[model samples]
Target chain A: MSSGYVPGLEGIVASQTAISMVDGENGRLVYQGYVIADLAEQMSFEEVAFLLWEGRLPNRSELDALSLELANHRTLTQAANITLDALPTDTDPMDVLRSVVSVQGVEHRLGKPSVPLAIHATASFPTILARFHRRQSGLDPIQPRADLGHAANYLYMMNGKESSPEVVRALNTYLVLLADHGMNASTFTARVIASTESDLISSLVGAIGALKGPAHGGAPAAVIEQLELIGTADNAERWMRDARKRKVKFMGFGHRVYRVYDPRAKILKEMCRRMNPKFYELATKVEEVALQILHEEHPERPQSTNVEFYSAGVLQAIGLPKGYFTPTFASARVAGWSAHVLEQAAHNRIIRPQSEYIGPEPRKPIPLAERV
Target chain B: MAEFSPGLEGVVAAETAVSEVDGANGRLIYRGGYLIEDLVPVVSFEEAAYLLWHGELPNESQLDALREQMATARTLNKSARGTLMAMDAATEPMDVLRTVVSAQGASKSLTKPSLDEAIALTAVFPTIVGAARRRGQGKAIVEPRADLGHAANLLWMMHGEEPAPEKVHLVDTYLVLLADHGLNASTFAARVVASTGSDLTSCVVGAIAALKGPAHGGATLAARNMLDKIGSAEDAEKWLREAHARHERFSGFGHRVYRTYDPRAKILREMAKTAAPDLHRTAARTEEVALAILHEAHPERPNATNVDFWASVVLTGAGIPKELFTTVFATSRVSGWTAHVLESLADLRIIRPASRWVGPEPGKKPLQLTKR
Candidate 1:
């Protein structure tokens, strides 16, 4: 009965590949028809990306080509670097990403009559990430290396050094975890923009802006801070208790989608173990303490650990600074976001919903002087 | 020349009888006499929503009608379910809502009354959020309970089981706290959409896009990140100093609207006091340290703690995970968004803003020597 549609029937279907599937009854997740568990364990982030776009696993040659292409595009343009350098250092990373993506659109001259969506994303993603890292590190952007892998090249540009296998693996896992989720805010924004038949860069810019919201891609690093507050297990219960008293929300626990467990949590937990055994132990202890307290306090709510819980641990164990958690999330999520934009574009339609107006009814004009 | 509504700086304050913003004094009074805390203690979310919409307390029958209407609207269509199921499991839940709501416009019956349809349209919002989340977890969707109140049903649907009465009440209070604010960005966007006489879904979709911005509903997640970065109280000062030095905008501190203190912070702080006593102490200390540092650093910007600062504490204490903070915000805000949309429909007008065109007025050939 609201302005848009009958409550149950709106925006329910579209023609697109299922980027991810949520089986609410069983608490499971799958991406691009592949079980999340399988992808997290077996496939590289680049491979997962290919799967999302190509609709199947890539052969070795195809994957190698895609990797080379992605790596080649990792370098930012001179104009892009200039634009990023001109931005204020205090700018939120999301805003930075948005601005850079917009500029990329201009610099790449994406407005050219006909450009493929894949080419746009492929060219834009690396440039966006590289420029973002450059700005964050107070350095000028680097040129993309055609010889490196996507993960290796991104790390190279980000840190100005070749990444270790462990680091690349960690980054790859992070990317895989962040790659996609169903109809999230940023993806929706991308889809909305795409519905308008906006170019990929514009859609990506919108998506980046949407991702900046705290509710979306910004909670993983906060989980690490929560753990630090708990410190040793001795202080965990007390700290959690105190936190509960103040009503502070613990990072990385409950999720909107997963009532029982976040599948990504399991994957990240393993990744953390592989990265740093000590931090993994500490993280597990923190989780235990938080869970124990939650169970005792409000057992009825079904609060449990979600992706961010372990993601914080995994990223931290891998030696990434906490500030970069969100940016890293952006890097991985770019694939899924681009994919969703493409999907929306494939069946392009403007996304415009209605509203339920609840303000003072239109009134007769009141004299400005008489209106106290 | 296009007419501009100048000198209408604070006129909206008098027009919408929602909340009185004493920007200079740092106070927000909802309705005529009710302080935020006063309402927080006794008012249910449904009651608060009615007050915002009708500008008075709803009678029992009116309340019942609203409840029934919301209940009836809670069921999501199969198409929406499929769409949600198709999303990446790791994608942010709010993004999913934004996309679904935007796409929802296409499925509506435009011939129907916008308000009546909007009410029904928005009713299913909680279900969409709950269902999408559950589906991501691979859990079966729970059917909405006709007998339960709005908050109670939402919790039940989210968890796929019944919630304890106390938990229900807690969620209800949380929702009440989030129900509405003045014309914040997202609500303004909703109004913009409604002004065009578009459907409710479009308004809500636009509002969701706005809410996805970090400066808006995303603050809760950012606040959690700040807490995470600080780890323990001992680390707070150092972290704050570094962050400030780095020019990172602290999430939970400062506000665009409230010059002194966010009133919602007070209410949530009290609630945290009752629910999680231990977290309360840490949160209090955190607040103290943050306030001291903020006061010392930026004496000019009235760096009063806002709703997000305490809301994060309360929700964290209540054992809700950090990732859910923004989702919770969305849940509470949906009511306000719907109310604003309904308000916009009362006097239909297109919200088309004109820009000051500084370019040459009409097409003109360049003065070339050869041409001359």
Candidate 2:
């Protein structure tokens, strides 16, 4: 007998993962045994990426090797460059990232998912977004500096100059916090593709597509848009009340997995307070009003503020355009996507789940010309 | 925590009317309650696609409108063209497809998936596949003719000549047979992406990436390669015996869903006799020997031939090169992928399944980097 259909597979355990765990009940995210709260501010994005790919923290030499490898692969391939230019100057940055990454990883033959391929993919995401951003602004693309760290190079490539230390650290912290989480939609998409034995780039490309959805990584940019519409902290309650009356969704207010406040949101909220007081002022007011309204509407639901809520402010403070929010999320999550691909490859199984057919019984068809 | 389903094997993730694989009874049913066998003789690939998308077989005028719509949408947009030209001729066709399709669908803003977009995406697969083929052969790319039907246009673009009527019939039948099949891995990938409220192009692109895997769409090419190695009917037994002794799994002999002969495989096997007589003879004999050897080894299993086995011969007869088999498979399955995505929109919910954490305990503190 088949199991009954579970809509959205909500709470279904699909895999056993050692790479990361989202402890939703406890509001904790753990990567390879270390709590996210402990690692968020201290670790470089490169170290978190390594920890995701390999199931342990890399030693100093190993970290240096990964950093160097990632830096070396920061430039786009010739094909990727042409493909990047092929898109219109006004195309969405996420679309540009998905398309160029597909071209950058094109191969003559199928290659198994490997750590080197993971590094290659993780390195290219920022470059693709930065190049497209520059092109959109009618500026020449900047070359990536190998001497800079992963987060620093991405900033350098986008602005054509090195960012201050505080800004680089904030971007690096954002990347580290978002590098991996257990069985999210985009990660699930990546693992699903990899379950079919597809290569890492294919998996990552598919993940990027899934992340572009409004329900997932796409929410962060919308959060920024909503705050801009709210205008000032003084008008937050009135605007939000009217928007709710019109059945408009409060972006970044809810999540399905986290029963409590998202741990990443907690960290990013503090970052916003320190780095972007202007955005933080309005965003905090919006968050407070949105939460109060939601609670009044559904008191049964637990308090929820997802990672995307404060992520908008942190990314804005780091000087990224709002359009680049989802693609930048892809840049961080590619490390986790590739790690999941390798794990799925190691424990190979074709993930062809059953579907309950609700169609009619089979019947004969009429001839084309004889139909009434 | 729920029990872990390694591959979600028996999990019912969705309820769909798009198509069904009743493996228990060996029946294949498409939308509108039409058996695949019943629909094949009376309809073209365009009609089958229309049925899948609109949930009914199109009437004469509706079919004509669909054909016109498809014909007009066959040409690649400028971005897609430039992206296609950017890739080397030696790149894999599937990689070309994944990239070009992404470029083709890149837009200024995210749009909801729609029927018009679905039809356009399905219509353009041949253009990308044909250009990839011509580029691989160092030949001039051929423009699609509006007068030709879907199957004929695909053949015409690939070969730079009008396709024979019989070959068109064979290809059309193949397309109809493969247009939809239950919750297949690639279709599931498409649905998973779509469930996040992503665009149709992203869903189709994700599906193409999954289909490139050897275990899914790539099985057809692998089947043809295996047959080529066996060479003739006389060598079937010896080659199979040696392979079985060496513990090599036969390329196209097993499937996860079917307990009996695949209905589509039965249809393709019959068509292969008329399409490629000599190869058909060799395939028939090889099938007999492979089945016996498999039965001897695993007497309890239902080791019947899959659709890929006979599809390889029929496609070969239709003059499709082995290298493009997977891409050709994507061409047929895009309709199904888009159909599934559209169906999922009525009750869209993010498919974020949970994962069991099997890593280290959560409270481990990290030592300073220099101490390591």
Please compute DockQ, using alpha carbons, for every candidate against the native two-chain complex. Answer: 0.01, 0.86
What range of 10 consecutive residues in model 2 chain A has the weakest lDDT sum? A363-372
Give the CAPRI class of candidate 2. Answer: high
Candidate 2: tens digits of C-alpha lDDT, residues B1-372:
777778898899999999989998888899989988888889999989988998888878888999999999999999999999989999999999999999999999999999999999999999999999999999999999999999999999999998999999999999999999999999999999998889988999999999999999999999999999999999999999999999998988888889999999999999999999999998999999999999999999999999999999999999999999998889999999999999999999999999999999997897778886
TM-score of 2: 0.99
Candidate 2, position A71, lDDT: 88
Report i-RMS for every model.
Answer: 20.2, 0.9
Candidate 2 residues A1-372, lDDT tens each?
578889999999998999999988899899999999999999999988998999888899999999999989999999999999989999988889889999999999999999999999999988999999999999999999989999999999999999999999999999999999999988988998998888899999999999999999999999988998999999999999999999999999888888998999999999999999999999888889999999999999986888999999999999999999898888899999999999999998988899999988778877767665
Tell me the docking grade of candidate 1. Answer: incorrect
Per-model TM-score (chain A alone): 0.88, 0.99
Clashes of each: 90, 0
* Candidate 2 RMSD computed on C-alpha atoms after optimal superposition onto the true structure: 0.9
